[model samples]
Target chain A: MIASLALLAIGLALVVVGPRLAGARWTRQAPWLAILTWQALTVAAVAAVVLAGVTLLIPITAVADDLGAILHACAVSIATAYAAPEFLPGRLLGTVLAGVVPVWLLVCAARVLIGGWRARRALHRSLDLVAEPGADSGGLVVLEAAAPAAFCVPGRTSHIVVSRGALNRLSRRELDGVLAHEAAHLNGRHNLAVALSEILLRAFPRVPLFAVAAVQTRELIELLADDAALEAVDRVSLASAIVSLAEMRAPAAALAMAQGGAALRVTRLLAPEPPMTAWRHRLGAVAALAIVAAPLFLAGYPALSAALSDLCNI
Target chain B: MRPFGELEAAIMKELWSRGEPATVRDVLASLSTSRTLAYTTVMTVMDNLHRKGQLDREMSGRAWLYRPVRSRAEHAAALLQNVLDEAGDRQEVLMHFVADLDSASVAQLRSAVEAARRQGDSAPGDAG
Candidate 1:
């Protein structure tokens, strides 16, 4: 029990501190909330792990004897992971974990970073391919590719890149609709939204829910972009653009275009919004919160105490 | 980014579960497990979400077909991001998120960035 408490404490501390370091660059909409959720969920997850590990590692009676030792190590790692560095001694476990966990987190960050980089590069290529600098061709830049497609690459250096195929496949009005949709991505920073899902994947590998979040977020991003496009273009044109894009060849990640056969995207394109997505996101938020929170506190009292202390003390 | 009230949320939930646009009856049918929702209430909420730029409404023969303007995943991602940011407690959580990332991803991000750099002579902020 004591050992579990110690682990719980350590886990709680990570939840409190991890986001500040890792989720800082989330760079999407609701920057703070996203990081905090990740932090809360991640910490809760780690606590569950520790709680389970301790349960398996130490017998009930034997937990007391190891409490001090576990607490010390926990303190060491938490301090190393977050403290001023001068505060804690560089112990072996601390060093190992300090090195390992961040590297683990980099897994998610790496995707965004790489994708962002490739996107940046691809943006340049697209720009060069089109020779349009803020040409305002309705915020759509025709790329040199042959397949009709669209996607929104988010970031400060973001763009709604399109290909010749997409332009050719889609009528001028449909292309205009596609451009409007892509513009919405940049304006809404859907890329950042997808990035959050990516981070969730890294943090929660065991839970397939993260993938669900990814899928849902991708669809929502499209919807939000579609809404934005609707502002600048005609609904029918936008709908047709989505339908045609759905029927066109798939494009790269940054380019959110209508693929030839994205059934769901096609369905959404054919239909418009009502109460479905909003509530689904809400439920996801609730479920995600519960799943994330339950694990952290799975140790019952130990996890509860740890969380209370961390929040109160903070 | 705020919670869209439990009622509106419930209505949206119904639509999302069906994976398509729905009417008041459709929303109501899926929500039968919950409290009773007025037909007008569902109508109003979907109309509200539609106005909020969250839902898309299309005219049908006599009524409007309601669909999600955004997918559940997209909204959750956005909400998760918001949840991450709620307290501005950047003092710790950020580190935890970053620290948890495995090295392979870190290297990948760096490699991608490096590749991007190589692909274009543009400065860090100006990729154009």
Candidate 2:
């Protein structure tokens, strides 16, 4: 029980502090690794908390001394609260924490998804009316407005939108850079990642990890797309396009070509860094593995042993 | 098959080609030659276009006559311009548009363009 509580404490602490410790600069330096780290933290934190709750029930049923008796005890308590009067409080708390929290999280996730779906439907309906098939061969839709904007709507048939303003304002090279950036987002399926992060953040708002991860993931995906765009566009052109288009806004549901942290993106473009070394890559992998595995082992091992012993004793 | 934006394009084409305000019936007759469509569908499409500020409608007797609000070229430009006038958190929606650029940064970009031009290198070309 003490060990379970300690593991749970560690998990909670990680949930609160992990993102802060990572810091924005760390993530900006190695976004892919940062993504892995954030994902592991979120998963491990949830697993740890749930496992901790379940583990607490282990000692209460330890008298049973085996797995079968532990289940029987749990079922009996749930059926009639008085069945295990001595351990009723722990049983109730464990059941509530382990069962109710997930359901609540699931509900929150559903709400975010439904909202996103509705927003997408509304946007597509309006976009269909306002935009025209672009003259460019890439199957983009050109909006008549003079706002120098470009973005991609993600779906079965994703459409890239480029305003006439952007086409007129940007030189050929600059326009290509902008289009490539938007295309990178579409091809990479960054919308799904952004959506998932959004769902998780809304579902678990209190978990500092989710909030930070959501923001960082959003930022990282843009950087990733920018990197992909660099293959076809020179640094100066991409940077210039990003700056010029910085004033244009994409709809909330869509991933705009040059959204958020424009200055940081521009700076990174001008002074590009070499990819991380193999040793650093290995270190990142190992760190991610450890972060994900720690909570599960700490919380699960004790619960399993206690449940087995309780069943045997019963 | 008419997909997505094509309905609006077709309706706009009819209006633009007629070069005059026409009733829904007139637009429908013109569009029907390409592909048969119901009057209500055409009416609804036109009504939506009007609501979107793409079409202007005026009542003629008991029926409403509609025309393109602007020339095809002007309309396209207006739609793109509207993208800049969106109401929301400016930072949140900031995408390709530059909200802020100091004189120095703009100058730097100009020089970069000059260098690129001198080198005869265009943006390595668009998406493959």
Candidate 3:
């Protein structure tokens, strides 16, 4: 149990800090996006290779099972209490997760509800910008503000909002660029990216590397949006608009691809790789998968096999 | 508009008639002598086209050369797609346009789709 806890701790620590120390070098490359993707691949590859390699060498299958069963048993008791909340659940966390599952879960459930309410309230409040009615493939929701920008608030139903100042300033051509950029954000599920980054960062705050990785991921999301807009419109127009809007683009607020600054995006737009012809895109996807698998292989078979077995429990 | 009114369409048209990445000077030179154009005005027009996402540009010393990123066929297809997407449930309008497709063109489209399906089928993981 001590060893397992140590391993988990170390893993979490690496997850948090490793990105900051090393991720910066990659984001500086010519096509920051290509490098961003490469870093993501690197993270997955490292994780997989480490897990598979450790699993191959160490056989902790039995102990892991015992630990998992204990955890599961605890979970079941907690779930039961929640299912039947009449059980006088005294301070849940202080008592329930104190090896008394039911009370803990009630506490957790309460916490989650409160957190969700707060989050919803914050989201409703943040959307201070008015929505402009746009007629496009998916109706566009524009926020007319002086903040030269674009961003998609991600969820079950995504909202693409842009600033009013952006609309007023941009020519129709430039407006197309901004609209397409925002569309790319929606299509890419960048809100998830932001959420994932935040979760990863919060989970492993010590690892400066994780923060670096998150920042890189954020920038890459913008680049990806720029790439999509290029296809919908002309690269030059996108690039020009990005340059023009750099002054007006907002910083990342929640889910949107905060309008990018001029220098990097413009460079990429002016000289994109012919939209990565289909074959090349396929190659990239394949490479990403391979990298994703490497760390899983390293995590060691015993834990993996145990995980597979546990899947039956689900 | 001038080109449409008088350009003798034969082996070439649009950007091709002038050749790829033609400059304002190049296009003006080709234009029949009617109006004198200053460099900045022509530059601005090309710039506008570029900004409109109609033209792609490349750096050439102090100036930039521009090209049409999409071919004429692609532009037409995109316009058609855009119209279809915009026309909310305009079945009659859509059917009228579909009827306008020449028999040979329709045949070509059918063959193209068949070929695409065949190719897709042949590709790994394409089958359910």
Q: Give per-candidate clash totals.
A: 77, 31, 35
Candidate with more favorable, higher lDDT: 1 or 2: 2
Identify the runs in model 3 with alpha carbons over 4 angstroms from their true place: A1-132, A135-137, A142-148, A248-261, A273-292, A302-314, B1-128
- Candidate 2 vs candidate 3: which has greater lDDT? 2
Candidate 2 per-residue lDDT over residues A146-226, each given as its tens digit: 545676666656667877767777778888887788788778777666666676788777767888877777677778788
Which window of ten consecutive residues has the lowest lDDT sum in model 1 chain A? A252-261
Candidate of highest lDDT: 2
For candidate 3, the TM-score is 0.43
DockQ result, candidate 2:
0.23
Q: Write the per-residue lDDT of candidate 2 for residues B75-113, one digit (tens) a residue.
A: 556544544445222212223323344444545555554
Docking class of predicted structure 2: incorrect
* TM-scores of all predicted structures: 0.43, 0.73, 0.43
Kindly report the root-mean-square deviation of model 2 from the true structure over all alpha carbons.
6.6
RMSD of each: 21.7, 6.6, 23.9
Chain A TM-score across all models, in listed order: 0.54, 0.80, 0.56
Compared with the true structure, what per-residue lDDT tens digits does model 3 show for residues A1-314?
22223333444554555454343433333233454354554355235323322322232222335567765644443333222222233223223222433344345445544553344333323332224455555645555334444444444455555555556776677778777777666666554554444444544455565566655555666676776676777655565565445433323222232222334555555534444456655665566565555444433333444444534355
Candidate 2: residue A47 lDDT (0-100): 74
Question: Interface RMSD (Å), each candidate?
Answer: 20.5, 7.6, 23.2
